[model samples]
Target chain A: MAAASAERRGPRDTIAVSVRDVGMVFGDVHAVRNASFDLPKGRFLTILGPSGSGKTTLLRMIAGFDAPTSGEIYINDRPVSAVPPHRRAIGMVFQKLALFPHMTAAENVAFPLKMRRHDARAIPEKVERYLELVRLGGYGGRRINELSGGQQQRVAIARALVFEPDLLLLDEPLAALDRKLREEMQLEFRRIQKELGVTTINVTHDQREALVVSDEVIVMEGGLIQQKAEPVQAYRTPANAFVANFIGVTNFIEGVVAARDGASVSVSAHGCTLPGVAVGEALAGGDACAGAVRAEQIRIAPRAETLGNLDTLVEGTVVDAIFEGERIVYEVRVPGLGDQLFRVFDHDPVNHLQFSPGDSVCLGWNARDMHVFKK
Target chain B: MRRSRAAYPWTWRVMDGLESLAARLWPARFEKGLPYLMLAPAVLLVGILVLGLVQIGDSSLRVLDTSTFLMSEDLTLANYQRALTESFFATVAGRSLLGSVIVTIVTLIFAFPYAYLMVRTPSSALRKFLLVALFLPFFIGQVVRAYGWLIILGNQGMVNEALGLVGVPPMRLLYNYPAVLFGLVQYMLPFAVLMLAPALTAIPAELESAASSLGANWLRTFRHVVLPLARPGLVGAGLVVVTLSLTDFAIPAILGGGSQDFIANAIYDQFFRTSDQGMGATLSLMLVAVGSLLVGLVFMLFGAGTLAMTGGRK
Candidate 1:
């Protein structure tokens, strides 16, 4: 709430993009509902959502690829709803990288400049500078297919940024790469974005990428913007149940609100009441709700007595245990919590005694970590 | 697993048995030679063609004795010399060359948008309609289509009848150079579209979007990106249309009214009407040389991939 208020009060001159009640309808299907947001200049914003979540549709609307069925979009305080994509000064790195296979690396990078009719004498120099920016300086003579996958990505980035567009849009450019290379490119994208200070919007389904590269994150679902906040704020305090569940690995405990006190609510599930923070809307006694707890927030132990500092504790049997190098995931069915399977992440795997399938265990979490939302 | 195998359908069992029998008969050691063995029929057919071409070459070097109505015993260059220097043959060759080139250019201009629309249309029904319209002429065969055009474009035919309805008099729309070229274009339209559709489909649609997003308008996008990328298709379609039009016999024979004789019609005239086998063979060899030269030129300019010979790799 504070961050949103700060965004509204950031002054008109600083806002690089402002979308007002933008809606995109395709026949009978509304691909994007009324979405409104303000992105401050030089801030990297990532719209994160799973496939078919309308995140790409929203980005396409902002890039002028698809006109909004309602309202308008302002880029640097200019209404650009009627402008065609070519007329808008926006660079986009498509999902497939869409590098012109016919052009050499330097030629591809010089494409935008040539199209925009930049001074012919300066195209080569600008192309070289952008290639160097993407660490492909001497590779200007190489064709697109001649480069490796990562090198092709660099060529695409150079091509997009060489023209110095007002906005840079990345449409899951790293989605096709291997994990190690994707992580490297993610950092590279952030460094270059920060260096260029271009107001950018990247659409991706990668939550870690959204958190790693963006100054702000917008989580969308079912053609609607569910939450728009800083990455940490979105992770720490999601606006609703969907945002909480979508952004991270979370376990939901179904219950009815037993009592409410200020910002916290006690949810009665199985035979006991669990304390949790109420998010998004107010709740009262007898209201149906569910408390969402992050998997890492829960601690697992062999005995119940050892979880002394936890605000809530329950006994369970390990249904499955997965050893995932850095952390161990234990799926525990807690009988005290109606035999519902609860996932608990143990961060300290080397020091802790690992639990195996069918082993008796205890799960514990604090009230602050569990966010309760009305059903 | 044994019980499942026993429970398999009779067709599956038969297929399994046949496979094992074939493996035992042919064996894995001979697997490398199987592909070569499969190509035997095509090689044999081409070998026969090469032998016939050699026969034609041998005959082309001889001159026909018109008085005795027999080819001369001794080989000579008289036939080749006569075919090259004669004004009649020269006019026919020049007309065929000019006509084929024009047909190629005009056919490609017409086929490109048709193929592009067929490949890019979002509606399956529209694509199906375009495909059906393109292939419908192919089913009607070239000779039959030329006859059909003859019926429509004749002096008192449907086209002239319509013009007559406007009180413009039944003007001659057939038996001319334009009529022959128009017939060739109509005959080659399907071939051009079929050749170009796959090439257009191979290009990723995103490349066009990328071009537009990079500040190129629709026309610039086509010139800078789509046109260059679709070059292999254009070159290929052009080659097919030109070569086919150059070698065509039926369209000119039906529509030319004996005036607009293409090279094929001239060769037919030498062999049948004039009873000059040596001259016909000479013209046949010359046509092959011209076609080969044009194909060689295209390959030199745009590599073998222009015909998709080397996987169309850039």
Candidate 2:
């Protein structure tokens, strides 16, 4: 990966680019709304969303392509509402890899320096230095067309970083590549963003790409930030149904919060008085929310478990089962929620699980693992 | 226009005409040569035009005075030498050439961006408006347009009237090089825009956005990225503009007020007014030769630009 070969050298890492209340209105369309965040130096922040979810629009405001309709942006604590994109010292890698086709690799990297009116004498050395940083040292004299897709992407990175902009912006950088190439580039990008100690913001729809690279992930939907958290936290304890469904596969059971208490709660769900705790906020009965539980959280067996007394346990028939290479997924039939599935890792099927589509089994998990919401 | 596949029904009148014509015309043509007979009109036109140009060249080489149309057909250099030595004719050529080159350059500099913007701007309504607005001048005759400019720039017209209001004296503007240049640009802006529009439109929007996001904003992006990619369109626009302006007669004739007549007008004078058909033919052929040379230079310099603007000849 280019980033691995790059040498780590820069000032102490800190927050450099901060976006506060950033929103953009292109005519009647609100492309982005109320987007407030800060990007720290030497770290990567991946703003992830599907198309039209506003991640690209937010990145544009950072690059100064469009000013927020009502917001302020800051680069190193200085509010840069009035600064133009070229003057803002922000490096951006477009999805198309926007390398100047007419110029060779070295000249493409040298463009930003020329724009900044840097000494022409030092441009050649500066070009070599950044090209080396991206592990594309010898490829500098080549035309952009001569390079591979991965190599062209590296050249684009070399170009953006050559300017040594305070913040580097990547707009769906790996989106155009095939799945294997994308995964390969994802690691390379994370490494390069780290090695240069340049604060980077990546925008993508690929969840795995976001989880694998970003120190923090911000998921956006419908021009609003759905949630912001580290990958593990967002995965395990999503704040809302959208967040839960967006992060990873989760089983959702409609429930009502019958009671509330500190750190834990009891819920009446599936026509039964069940016990659960709020994953985000305490809720009461009749509130509109959902209870989400991971598939693997439910342990299914022919017999009951030790937590049978305190566990949210129910006896249900295995509606179906599918062997998914590493795990077995059993679509267990619950009385109220119909057929909600439970997954168990297939370490060895002989010792752990055995079930047919119609066999009755007890699905159960501890109350601590039961995430209840008012809906 | 009739659709290609549909055929007219076979009726009695058609059958009679077909039978009679085939009996008379098709009989001889089938037995002899129908293909050459069919190709005659177009071939004859081309033949006449080429032979006419050669005859003009031959006439231009012969000796001539008002007393006799030509003293000799010996192909002397006197007519060519006399044409070269005449300051009035030479000055007309120089001023016309220089003025047109400047006008075309300025027209392209201003029109190309507008053409590009008209095409790239997101709203289809706006693009349509721009397209229609660009071609609107086409419906108006150059003579009428030239007269309109004369009023606007004349001493007692809108331009002088505005200057008078600004506490400056009304100055002579009509019947000058500037007036002529302005008239020519107005006459040719639409053509320049038309030549450039398709080329500019053909350059994908992904190209410029790609550049801007790469740490290069509008100006740097335009200079390095958009302009280079649009180089072909620029060349095409230059060729069209230069060609039109170089041979422009009506605009210069009206606005130049006899001070800035070009080769077109000079050729017309030699052929019709001055009764020097040989000199007029020489001037006309010179215009074509210079135009061809300029076009050759355009093709050599900006290959893509020529291709984009003029559709590199098949």
Candidate 3:
């Protein structure tokens, strides 16, 4: 158990939440396996994963809704493995928002305070304050169904945070919102989290949301924590192929590592040698590997001379060109790389020459842009 | 068109020809009226019921003449007057009303957990078992079930046999008000559970989790979250159980050993045993009014719950 050690460490570490070797198994299925992490006080963390990636199970365990089959979870230097969810000072916003339809926004916010035995005299004021904080000041009298979708979300947040729990867990509350509302709420969440300085853990499958909202992101797959790092680090230097593929639109070129030079490796794919940066593990000669390159990192031009000075350049025919508002994405098939389609993002779509499908184009990227990992 | 029809099977061609013929007769312009046309059968059935009620009402006002063995030429309020003033009638009416209320409350209390378990149980086998148990009673008619209780709670029954094994003598559990009420509750349990299941299922399981995570213990969660959200189901189930128990005749007839009589049994006794059609008609009209008034009160208090066909909250 992490109890004795956590007690010895005491309040000196400033660790608000410490999950140690937590694992949850449902019958024969391992939902979460040997998950461990320490979240510093006042920091926002997100467990990022695909639908069946055990992110929710991990969050549930930390929130005390679930008892981990093994290991313990500590909240502010106290072991909470045996604590029930209500006894544990944790607030959660559900995926569906789960606002009580019968109660008004203020009443919903006042619920936790009432249940937690807060002072009856101070409850109305506290509920008002939290509702206002969520920017739903005068909307308190409105029933949950009476409010708009975004307003309902604010009410849910206020309700969760009104009791001032030790930690806040968000079980993908914004997943149900439309894209525009979701993005707006993401920034709103970030602002409130910063304003309150509550140690928060959010679970989401939306990669962009994880990157946008969290100070740290823990990526999981197959009930295993694949990578845990700051958002930029997780994005720029993924731990393994799963993290690399999961985070963003990346092209994976299957190959064998020809040689390793410090942090960089040269992978020979289909008789073409591609220079790349090694990720997760060092690659020896003849080790099967895949070099991952981000869509934005690759530059596409009409001809070889048009492509700026780069370490590697390949001539390929444009397969498809998609016009996405801010950027133009072109899928290019490079014969030199064995007809593998390489995606290139044109951020300055207005200034760039838009290449149509079947047009021959030159794609180039720096060697450091490609992350080489063992297959 | 001929080539397309020729490519199809004989069944398909026949169906297509029928569809085209029907379309030709119906036409697209009359589509708006189709829904109302479909409602004709239900409306006609209700119209027939209203006509029957009118005849009953007409008979209810007429006094029965003992010497002639026929209704009097002139209408009167004699039956109503007797029904309102008589202690026997008062006791039966009071008993039915009070018994129905108790049965509704008890049935709802028992059904909430049953319906909740059926909806929320994680194990499919357990859910299936609960569903089967809830529906199995429906297969046996209410009258048959009352008889089953008569056998089970009788002096020489299984329950008394078990009690006798402990040196306790067989008790007179039948022919009492409690026995009738007990029989009614058992008969109403399935209807209550059936009415409640959908309402309970409408409530997302996540809300409970949300409630617990928001610092509500399971008991508090049930009180504050589950109970409030399941109001529709409770109201719906309560309304059904109350009305069904109120009008019930078989349970009181069989289980009460002729001592306990509900409104329906009283109506039956007047129409058959006493040979008073006017009294029977009066009781029948009163029962209809009482049932409607109860249902109306429920709608007024709880907005018709799940039974309200209106689109949800404004």
Candidate 4:
């Protein structure tokens, strides 16, 4: 298999894909506007967004399916805006998998090799190698409809990578699978991508899939990239309110900045002062601001005195409590913070006492966990 | 299980009354026969057709006595023997068969691209324009369309008049085998396209894009992927066009100038012009047998393309 040789040649630290000021407009609607990003070799970058957020448009442009209206895209520093999709050395697993229903799994895997006119003698060995790469060694002769959905997905992946293209694109191939299979395939894709060290760009609306599979996640909204960062940085330090609201369940506290100290700022809302880390644009005193804190970042205690060694604490009453299998989510309405309701997740439910509705509680979090942004 | 009737809603009571009334009118066993009851009219219509065919079969065995202008009382195979032996009937049958094959091949070749473009075009106006052009001939009768072609293709017609302006002599473009074949093709184009459109539409656009991404160019993609996937539509459209053209009478009657006669034209002459019912009935039965044999051959070779009558396992 070429996989062993591919692994021997480790991934190089060079820019694999570069998009410069790309824009796409269809009649009156601006589908993608002023998008730009660079992905290094052998890294997995996922463009994450909701439907109609231009993520798919951007991916299509990169794949040479759609031409950008404004700027150019480069594969290995060569501008490819004029190249046709067939000529481009890129493999794509479509949103629907797009496996040919008429062909057997082996034929499906052999298509790219046949199209590229690989050596006639080497075709079968290569096909079998890729089928084995996808862990479908003995089942290559089965037609597409005879295979399960997950097996069909493996066929698509193998077919896309059979030619050993310079770059691979995944267009939400797991969006239709059930949750368990989707998660399993996410890990499977990550493993295959790493093993082959193929530069890949995946587009998906599922944020969890993005975080699980991608080395970097690019969050998009309304035809613009809101933030592009590593998964941890994106989850911990979102660039703006959209990224914060889109990535995870976050509670926003609307207030005015009363004090600013380097990276930290104090925001006053409903006559209560709260400390938070200042992110994005600089903030001056009396400037309108919003504080974002993730549900898991905040801890809920039975009393204010019980939660010690925290940066900020506020007393509130539990307005609602939902018991999920792994964790319990509590919605607390703080009286001192503009009567705002904050969600806190209790991960250690067995060790910690569960607070029911109408029970008095205290919500506490570190100042670094709260991201303060200009409203 | 019996529940209190008074406890149920008024709607339930009304439904119950209707159900009991139905039960009294039709026994429960009759429910199983409802589908066959609905099929009775179609079956009766076919039975009547079979009876007429039987009568025709009997009549085709008798010879017409020209002196008395009446069929002979004694049955014989004279009509069939004469039809098989006559050179005129052989020429007509051969012309019809050859012309139908040519027309079907030409029509399918033209209709496939037209149907594909109509189905794949992104512009709604273009698709609507193609659809309107296809159906416009349907609004005009086949005979009228054939005559329209005659006027357009005749010497000193619109085309010849345009040619005259260029200082060229008026050419006889109508009333020939080519003209008859051309008319048949034009008439059958829409039927072929209509039959093929649904099958083409069943192909998802993603498959094309997928093929292109997998390194097949547009032409290769069409040849390898689109063409194979559209086999059922092609076969179905081919069958319809072939049979329709083989039995067609109007195009040859109007465009052939009485020189190129199809099977239906010959049958018409046998029944109406010569008033030979025996010969007409013989020719009619032969036409049916020929069409059915062609269709049967197709089903055997292609396994009912796009009909999907086969088991799921293939």
Candidate 5:
């Protein structure tokens, strides 16, 4: 919490990593285009994007594996465009977890220290300390193949951290594990990052992982950053349509702006006027726009009177109702909205009325919950 | 719907009938031993070789009489005694062993970088060019290649002609120890490269990147990761080059002129030139023993299954 507040008080010198308008082009393809971000000290930032979206390319530039065609990256305010990877004070966990198969666990962990020319007597103790840090204590004598998949992950983490690098980079290291193990490791990564207070930059396509483990998330698409904000802010107030749809289950209703008053806008769609807050660029009257609403923000009731207190109401038939333990997700087909489908989550597990397929229900939400963006 | 016999192609019907006929002739009970049955010819060929080796061993124990030029009826250890005591045979055996070791070492030193570059190059054109150059000599026979080398390295040849342009005299570049060693190394290069390529390919390119990120330069990565992983292939290639060069006949016979005789040249001279079959048989058995001992030593140093293709745990 103290770190979070300190990051909120953003000062220039506290920034640990800054990518200044970095771009990379391979032949004719632009792998990354003018990407720039500043990571404060002791903060975890996740670069989240789908495949071929330049997330990995940006991480590679930061790690010095590949040079950017333009722009520069700085670690601790030092311009590192020309420094080789081995000379940089950065550690990386690869997607494949490339532990040396020829060496035992302890030897693999000890490699970086030996390469850095640490004191010979201090190397073994530091390796043991890191092995125990990753919870692989007393198992360092076994070869890599003798360990399980998760244990290999532990060894990779230990090896990357034992050298005490200035920054750590994770390139989707947990992307290959089973869900249970992946979630467990996500929390483990969070714990280790917090305990060590090392600035980290993780690249992943897993949205849930980005939200769970990162202090800030950078959502990217088409080799460009769409949004860079705190996880909840990025989820609640996305910068554009791409981020809204990528981060959560968002329903976008096409409409035209009918009226604008300061921050509020009324959009006319499917013979109804839907009120929403104008976001991003200002929208003029009659301009084509979309009203983005999250599934959990809307309420579902059996009848219109039950949803009387809400500012907006619409009638829909339940197309599908899925029971997901603590909540029920109902896919409602709203006929007034051009027969578009809208998903609604009812979290009242005890008092909620279950709606079956083809049952009529009313969905309601406040106008503030809808974000209006111009098409 | 069931199809009639006419609906099927004639080739398919013939194959089906042949398969059923083979099954009936072999019977289901004997199916389990089919692999061993198929191996009978190879096993028999090896058995014949072993039998010939035993006959040679028997002959190696006998002595030839100078008056009749025929072996003695009773077996004796006279030939073995002569082979062990004679300095001429000792010098030939030592030269062969030493030359083979040098050839093996030099061949591997040249082949490692060639094979590594061939496997690691991102350009397909360069890789294809290297591959063609390596296999070009293979299509030409070894004896023809050695004769070609003689033309290239002889006085007033291309090399000497180039040297003559610089006012240097034409040198004696053929029929020496270094010439024989150089020919053996050239001949064994393709074999060594072919053996090492697969092992180098088995290592992931990502491993090198990982090493670099983990604070290793290119040289350190090669020494720590690549050299260790490629040991099995090195040992396997070394065993082959050593044994083949140790008992090699053509390179030494063609390049040695008259002075530098290896074990194989001595054996050939004993059998054909001197008309001494007993001495030739003795040299042949000793060569086999020496080759086997060297192979055994390699297997002991490395493992017996060093060249296994599976990617399982070591």
Candidate 6:
């Protein structure tokens, strides 16, 4: 109980796996173009992207399954580009879970040991230790197919770790599982990685999975790294329009920065100005800057014009209203900006949501809640 | 009360219930069975061929009087004993087994590399041309191919003529065991390649990389992963080549010079030339049984050994 308390207070160390200008191409098709990042070790770094954003390719190069066409990879301060996967001592749990279909759980765990050509006598014992570590205590003799999806995932982890690899790469390992099981595996993986203190890099396209599991999330799009930062940090402070839109729902309105104040600014859009928006300087403040209003941050019925000692408001015509369980998705048409979507959540009573799809109402937020970026 | 049918038992009620359930089920199952109805003619053809083979087996088991259509004499093991114990027939069987084993092993070694190259190498036209070339020798008349070899390896033939031009005397080359082995391998290489190519294609490219990533280089990967996986196909090819070698007559006849008589040639001699139909039938049955047993043993060893454990209960 005391040790658990200590662990709760203890934070992870800051060792990083640096990928430098790594790119790959099959003939003329560029798979990854100058993909680079300092993936902090001992914390989950998920490169979240759609299929063929070169996410899996990046992971493969890091795992040494494929060598980079052009750059260097350093894990724990060693150049690992030329190193073979087994020699590099990195473990990779494949997307298909690539468990040798014929081998038992013990044999699967013993594979890395076999690859290292360890003493045949010691393989069984080493295998049992890792299997037990993964909480598969008595499943050593069970075949891979005998294990359920989650159990097989744990066995794959055990197999990868049996040799105590320096780095572990998981290439979308939960892509095949159903929703509930995938979420369960995500939590289980986090706990195991923390307990083991092994540096792991996981590649996944599921944004929620990435957000829940990773310490740092690197968002990629169209073969380029869009943003790499902490999960909450990336969510709160997206570096670009792509990062903002890709991470979640945001009402990005094209505008120009018109006036600036101490911690707030005004963005002129579609002939009218949205005043008191925060153009926080991730990008240098310029006149032609774009502004964003997140749907979740938009207030619906709490229209008490409360911005400092004064008030600011913009009127929009409500075009559609969607009941999204606990929240309402309002598709409103601002006077000149055309259509804008805002999500109002369930915090107050139902009578407050007194607008229909065709009704016109004034919507506004605190200047600090809005974000402005370069157009 | 009369409508209730007072004599009806509970078992009858259950049967009626089951009948209704089955009536509901049968149409859907018969709708699925439409596909099998389409296969009926082909299946019947196969059944007829199997029935024919069974009749041949029955005929081999009897004592043929030759004077009667049916077996007028008593059934006998004497034919089988006569076929097995005869020195010439025994020697012929031994020769066929030994020759086929050597030839098949050599064919396997040569064929796997060439087949692997066909799959991995990047040239499509080259692979196609090579595939055509592989069949070219087989496409030529068997007599013509044998005679062509006879010319190449004979004392006064092209090979000896070339050597003689270089001031070397013609060496003896016609009709020998060396000639027979050469002819057998040449004859069976196409068969070996046809078997191996499909197996090589079936091996996923990921497996090769998987092995390589696990630190096994080309040779170790080929041995542990490639070869073991390809064994089923290799064994299948071996059965075909060995059976072909056992049942072969022309290759041995052309090259054996009466010294390397195969079982087929001996069976041929017994059936018509020597007028011993009983011994011939018995010998042919023995060869068939040998091939079947060999194939069955191989399947039991390799195919059955791959019995897999379930992978979901963890």
All candidates: DockQ: 0.81, 0.26, 0.72, 0.60, 0.66, 0.20
Error of 3 at A310 (Å): 1.5
**For model 2, what is the error of residue A163's alpha carbon versus the real structure, in angstroms, after optimal superposition?**
2.9
TM-score of each: 0.97, 0.79, 0.94, 0.93, 0.93, 0.79
Indicate whether candidate 1 or candidate 4 has the larger lDDT.
1
Order candidates by DockQ, high to low. Answer: 1, 3, 5, 4, 2, 6
Residue-level lDDT of model 1, residues A210-285, one tens digit each, is 9999999999998988888889999999888999999889999999999888898899998799999998656788
**Cα lDDT, model 5, residue B23:** 92
DockQ of 6: 0.20
Q: Which stretches of candidate 1 lie over 4 Å from their true place?
A: A1-6, B1-29, B312-314
Write one digit per residue (lDDT tens) for candidate 1, span B80-195.
99988999999999999999999999999999999999999989999999989988989988889988998898887899899888899878899999999999999999999998
Compute the lDDT for candidate 1. 0.91
Return the clash pairs for model 2, or none.
A3-A192, B232-B304, B232-B305
Q: Could you tell me how far off, in angstroms, the CA of residue A188 lies in candidate 6 after the best superposition?
A: 1.3
TM-score of chain A of 6: 0.85
Give the candidate number with the greatest TM-score.
1
The clash count for each model shown is: 0, 3, 0, 0, 0, 12
Candidate 4 A-chain TM-score: 0.95
Best by lDDT: 1
Shift of residue A337 alpha carbon in model 3, Å: 1.4
- lDDT string, candidate 5, A52-130, tens digits: 9999999999999999999999999999999999999898899999899999999999988887888999998889999
- Lowest-lDDT window of 10 residues in candidate 3 chain A? A1-10
Q: Per lDDT, what order, best first?
A: 1, 4, 5, 3, 2, 6
Identify the runs in model 2 with alpha carbons over 4 angstroms from their true place. Answer: A1-13, A25-31, A258-277, A286-288, A294-370, B1-78, B116-132, B161-170, B198-222, B308-314
Clashing pairs in 5: none
Q: Candidate 5: interface RMSD in Å?
A: 1.1
User: What is the per-residue lDDT of model 3 for residues B46-84, given as tens digits with 9 covering 90 to 100?
Assistant: 999999999999989988899988998899999999999
Give the TM-score between model 1's chain B and the true chain B: 0.94
Q: What's the lDDT of the predicted structure labeled candidate 4?
A: 0.91
Interface RMSD of each: 1.0, 4.0, 1.6, 1.7, 1.1, 3.6
Off by over 4 Å in 3: A1-13, B1-3, B6-33
